[model samples]
Target chain A: MIKALEDDLSQTFNIHFKNHDLLDEAFTQASYVNEHPHQGLKFYERIEFLGDAVLQIVVSEYLFKRYPEMPQGKLTRLRAAMVCEASFSDFAKECRFDRYIRLGKGEEKSGARQRPSLLCDIFESFIGALYLDQGRDAVERFVRIVIFPKLDEGRFDHIIDHKSELQELLQKNGDVEIDYELISEEGPENDLTFTVSVIADNQKLATGTGHSKKVAEQNAANMALQKMRGK
Target chain B: MIKALEDDLSQTFNIHFKNHDLLDEAFTQASYVNEHPHQGLKFYERIEFLGDAVLQIVVSEYLFKRYPEMPQGKLTRLRAAMVCEASFSDFAKECRFDRYIRLGKGEEKSGARQRPSLLCDIFESFIGALYLDQGRDAVERFVRIVIFPKLDEGRFDHIIDHKSELQELLQKNGDVEIDYELISEEGPENDLTFTVSVIADNQKLATGTGHSKKVAEQNAANMALQKMRGK
Candidate 1:
């Protein structure tokens, strides 16, 4: 069973772990170890701790070089979004890495096999195991193949998180209260178009229309960001 | 002047950088770059971001292997202390790496050179430079010589209950990883004797037998303390 797992994993990862024990440890969940303590198997959490850091550096270096003129604050925010649980979990599923996790009967019954957090940890632990077995170059090669393409496609830029960007810009010098209010709503209950206007320090900025209030506010924020970028 | 800086750094760190630009960037403070924008010379902030993550992963893996049985929370706390601003800044000054920092005229007037935060950032940036130029093995060797000695000297922050004193002693000035595990349980249900062992930095320090689990842990900690006093 484990041999088949290794075969499939190597095909997907484009590399084989020299130390198979580390690879097994990376996929083993704590719940599994708890259920089978006598097996003397380790779990992924500690390796996940290390891999989280590895991902951090790899992403940081990539961003630092990719956007050379970008400021440190912006780089930090982009890196956070790129390495976030949502991002890695999505990448894990995309790579079919989710098929290999070894959960205990309890966790399996609880339907934890598909949990985002678990998937994220597995992704990180796999990186850790790869780093230990194959070194950083191999890890970089894996990421360049698996993650950088998605990154280059701007898939992670919803990270642009416009509302927060607006808040950060407005609050750059001092604390300023920003509010968004639904200025208008039209059409039927099932298909209403809401308009939202953003106001900062009692000064109105921009208004935008969307299918929902949240979407309308985001659009409004986007308009304000465009203004900031231009004016 | 930059060449002299590199020579001095190579002497202290015992590794020469192949990419002098990165080495310069590592030591180049942001204030200095702002004063000389056309120099096309970058500052430490971006690389510092990478270095900070490198430091985190290196320290994390070190703790993970050193205290194989320690829990994640304690490992995290210990890593934080080791990599915190207070800790690295002292290391930077100890290596006299602070002497090489090039400050802007304004920053020099304000005496920013001796700032602990600045020194901390330099320490991290230097690590970043080393990792990029010489690779992880060289970075690990650098840490083994420069940082690990100070760590072994018991000099950072401090922490004990029976668990905590065994912890405090093992931890000394800084926090260390400690774990307690049940080794044995024997005899009839009502007359069962529980044996617990205390582990400090992944080594079994002592074990004790008692009627109750808590009593066994307390006795185990006490015995560990006695052994420490003797040795």
Candidate 2:
């Protein structure tokens, strides 16, 4: 399966991998590693990390100039909607990542490969592999041609607006007024640091810091979000 | 000035500002109030808010389909860079927002229009005004025609990767033990909340919450990024 995948991808991406382990890692779930450590199924966490940034820059540049009259906030929201986990999961499903994913016996039986979490991670890892194998151009072209078109046609299909999600999280199940507070400041006056605390009923729900107060608040709000996910 | 400005804009946008106040507000800086209490210059905050969402959705939809193979992480960073205050300021300047801005005597003397913060706000306000006047179509067209082109050009520009910045921040700050921890949980068994803390030197440097632990940690790590900027 590894050889077949490398053969299939090599022609498309125009790159050859010296080590099959890289591609194998991209398709290997963490569950697989826990089950068979001797199988050497490395997880794709590192690749996901690299791939995440690659996608951000490419998509951002596309949007920044694509909508010249757009204000910053709208652009930010749009980007979030387009690039979230649900969307990634959908894309991964379209690519049939579940079929190729090397899952642990438990995961395979439980259909964990189709889970949004694993799917999104594997998709990101695949992107990271492409980037590592052939650099930004190969990765960019593959993304633009394969992934983006699917996302555009299905913009609202699996999209989650972070602000809307955060707002809902604050309103639901929590017995407090969720407020974002700027807790600290640092850096030069031109570029400042803002530490924001997501407080529910005056107790800190979560706190995050960012370059701007809004960003810090958003981070804290997102923390508050995870604190209230399924509830 | 209102009529002349309207004439000039109408030539390009084919849109008219029914109330000149909206136009004025789009260009006004809060600093206008400092010098002239009676000078009734409405600041750009409201318009900035509206424009922010408009810009986001437009860019998001465009990007979602434009780059199909790119991973979520890279897409996010790119969007941030494009929608950041600095880029908005640049866009506002390119649009000559300063020349049209209605400033009080003090702000005018202080070159408030040229100020990045004020310009960024005004840029948002302009989008807000467009949205209020013409709905999404008008705003969308303006974004597609004006804003996106600039971003398209930025495709050639190098992007700053935030996650890598996180790693560098830890290394530079000499925090060998910097890592993310799961702090709390919420939600049902199907979906969960994960609160993550970024710790260094056995102290919580920052905490972020998200629907998933990965997102929570990313949010936390990004928040921790404030400590590294300009350092």
Candidate 3:
């Protein structure tokens, strides 16, 4: 078995897997193990479980420090988005983990190589292997290079933006026009309350009141999103 | 501010908090912060978030190393049972965290002192504080003392036993009779299979086939559990 990582893995990420067995296991699939049972090969799922915890702690600490005043509930939602299958698969692709996936012939033909869940699992197992090889600091450094840049670029900012969330949800089933209409303005100028209605695909879904137009629109979108979830 | 832990914390657990703020925050309830607005007291939720991740990695690593043959799905379920509100709260109580709980007058009057969720949060925040003060090894040592002994005592074994799980689920809403019957046996002596049916509260729940009567009963209970979850 080709158990050792390529030189680029060390040169790019400063990671040296002293344990070749773990490195091999990280790239191995369960199907591959089952197919070649006599080869004494191992799968990545066990390491993925460990790597998930490593990722969880790293993300949790990063968020805790980044947003000192933020509440736990919002931090949790943001963490979920960061470690989600879509995000992890993208990270795996960026790290070229897909190129190293070891699969049984059946799995390879079935296109398991390009599957998001498989990609996510391989990435996590890679992380798990890295954690075991070099401990949490090495894993943190790896994440700093691969994941933090995205967070710094505000890729995860949409997690807190209900308006963006509403747009994304509606846009999932193809493009749809989303309109925010200013329903009303009330009270004194200094203490004015704005009411906004969110209309998606010609349907007025929800109306919300807030201190500012942006806030009101966000609230409206929030209500609309909640309604959709309730169904 | 009483921002320091008693010497017993160090004596019993060998934990010394250099950052007394994190330690103080761990023991401070959210309600206390809400009530004492001018005092600048912080709640434990943020630290609890960090602590939860710290706890997760520790537990994950522990389980991974202990059970090399266990699958990820089973490992995940076992981890959940270990860190659940009921289990964590029990750990907190055993560590005498209840004596250190800081609550507002209203919360104290409402009996928040004995609440399991509150206990769990404090335990987690305490762990988070320890991680920040020390690091993963210290946190691991803490869990080794607090959580591992219970596991070694087979306290968490119930998590993997479907029969125990089904019994607990059925027993949740008071007592209910549960029975397992050997429905059939088939095939040659060396390749024989047993079919068992599980009945709960006089209603036939599910049937499963396995190599042995015990295995078949467990499989039946597993099916019943799945059906209950689906409903």
Candidate 4:
């Protein structure tokens, strides 16, 4: 079964697993390992760690060069938006990467293998395995081939417009209504500070204080934006 | 004058500069270029860009292996905290890096060279120039010699207490009250969601959010923590 999955993943990722056990370990969720530790299998969390870093480096470099004039803070926000789990899950599903994930009887019965989060993890672990098997340059090449295409196709300018982008996201996701509240105003009349809180439905998401109400709103919006983006 | 500066720098940084122009450019503030065309200099912003990525790669690789069990998010935060302009300024000042910066008559009168921000830029730009002149390994060695000594001396628990460190900084800096406010919450009741804004001294410093209010507050604190850590 492991060999067959390796063959299947090799076709999808276009890289053969030298030691097939790497793939086995990646697919073997901690639940399964806890159930049967004698299998000598580990979970993909370590690989996930490595792969996350690799993804950040690759994506950050791409965005840095792509938007050379952009300041560091914006670049950070953009990278966060692009490599977020939701986007990664979308990419993973598009590539049908979930089919290769190994699942225990319980997870398999519950259809946990098809989860976007699980798919994203397995995809990251796959990159980690590729790095181990083929090295950094090889992993970079694979990532560029697999991931950059989607990022390139994306309307990145929309990402820079944080408010509209976030509004669209909340609407599409059926998220609760997010409202901005003017929580406080302080300081001298000439240079007053405005404190704004972004409240989603009845709960507050983030509060921001700025020299002006607009800036405070934007700050609050940006924070709320990132929160949903991380989803 | 250049030779004297170089000797002083060499004694401090333990690295010899084969190209004095690179060193001069590294230490040249934008104000310097406003006068003295024969100073033949450029500002350090471009070099800061190059150095930022170079630092990220080096630190990422180092942290990846140093704490084999650390998560990617933690490594990222640690690297950001370590490589920020504020930290660079502190290190550079400790080595008298600001003293070497050349300024135009006007800037010299204003003490532009002594400004922490300018000093930090020169230090980072110097690292970029070193990477260009000597390559990654050499630059890495130079960084280790100049800065990591003090960082290494900290207790093991320092790695895990970014918020506490920031709080200590606030205490030392004096009279700054920091608070985090929940701005918004989204998603379903069962899963929930939250965003938080961090206010420092009645000014919004940063905002972050996660699955729970605690996580959101921590995230906001962490962002502010990163912002405060470098210098």
DockQ scores of the candidates: 0.43, 0.02, 0.61, 0.09
Which residues of candidate 3, in runs, are more than 4 Å off? A1-5, A160-231, B1-5, B160-231
After superposition, which runs of candidate 1 have C-alpha atoms over 4 Å from their true positions?
A1-4, A158-231, B1-4, B18-20, B156-231
lDDT of 4 by residue, B1-231 (tens): 557678986776567877777777777767777786664466666566556666666666666655454555566667677777777788788777777776778888887766777777777777877876677788778777765554444322245454454455576536778777889999999988899898878899888877888767766766776565442
Give the range of the ten consecutive residues with the poorest summed lDDT in model 4 chain B: B151-160
Q: TM-scores for all candidates? A: 0.66, 0.38, 0.68, 0.53
Model 2 error, position B196 (Å): 48
Q: Write the per-residue lDDT of candidate 2 for residues A1-231, one digit (tens) a residue.
A: 667767756675555776577789888777878988676456776567666656665565555544333445566666676667887788777766667888779878887867898888888888877767667677778778666665334353233333455655456444456677778999999988899887767777778777877667766765655565432
Enumerate clash totals for all models, in the order shown.
Answer: 1, 41, 0, 12
Q: Please give the RMSD of candidate 4 to the true structure.
A: 22.4
Best-matching candidate per TM-score: 3
Can you tell me which runs of candidate 4 are displaced by over 4 Å? A1-5, A19-29, A63-78, A102-123, A151-154, A159-231, B1-43, B46-50, B69-87, B100-129, B132-134, B147-152, B160-231
**Could you tell me the lDDT of residue B125 within candidate 2?**
81
Every candidate's chain B TM-score: 0.68, 0.62, 0.67, 0.63
lDDT (Cα, 0-100) at A10 in candidate 2: 66
TM-score of chain B, candidate 1? Answer: 0.68
Chain B structural similarity as TM-score, candidate 2: 0.62
Tell me the spans in candidate 2 whose CA falls farther than 4 Å from its real position.
Answer: A1-231, B34-41, B151-231
